[model samples]
Structures are given as C-alpha cells and as structure tokens.
Target: MLNTNNVDCCARVRHGPSVAGLQQALGNGAMSNSISDIENSKCLLVLATTAPTPIPSSPAG
Candidate 1:
C-alpha cells in the first residue's frame, strides 16, 4: 500500500503475465500453471516477489 519502498509494482506483480508460454516455446511445458494446478500439487516451486494477496485466509473458528 505504501509507495515509500523503492519496489513499485505491487499491483502489477499480482496481475503480471503468468509467463507460461515464453518458456514453453523452448521446452516441454504446460501452457499455464493455473490456480488449480498450484492447489493440487504437493511440490511446487513458487517464484514470487510477494506472496499472493486477496485469497482471504481461513476464518478463525
């Protein structure tokens, strides 16, 4: 929320291009790793500058 940090593009990162096609052009790769894929897989290589936001946390019961 604060722009004081030199790192801008908080919003852009969240909506950035998924980069699913560029690499695929050179190798065997899935077109896109959709949210479902990330949720279903046990092992994942998450490469993000920031953790995903807006995916509301579970309610404390």
Candidate 2:
C-alpha cells in the first residue's frame, strides 16, 4: 500500500542559504582545505546544540 513513486527520501537534507549564496558569489562551492588542515589551525570555532559533558567516574572507586 506504499506510494513511493513521488517520494523524496532525502527531502529533509539541506544546506544553509549562506553556504549556497557564498558559493554563488564566489566561483567555488567546495572547501578550500581538508580535515587535515585543522591540525595547523591557530584557533578553532566549535558550534553545538548543547554544552559538552564529562563522563562519570567508575562507581567502584
């Protein structure tokens, strides 16, 4: 009974408008550097939905 002909499995996937707009304003849409480049970065910017938490210590202690 499933109607799959018109469905888009990846419909929920998307990129922010800033990313697309910048790619249009500039000539390229791909990153200039790779993940390895992060190793040499002097500063880093991290974005997350929640604050990081530490793991609980062992109960045997």
Tens-place lDDT per residue, model 2, 1-61, is: 1865555432134334646766887766656677878888899897863346643332224
Candidate 1 lDDT, 5-41, residue by residue in tens? 5554433443334444445574533345578978899
Residue pairs clashing, model 1: none
Q: How many clashes in each candidate? A: 0, 0
Worst 10 residues of 1 by lDDT: 10-19
Candidate 1: what lDDT? 0.51
Candidate 2 least-lDDT 10 residues: 7-16
Candidate 2, number of clashes: 0
TM-scores of the models, in the order given: 0.29, 0.37
Q: Supply the global lDDT for candidate 2.
A: 0.57
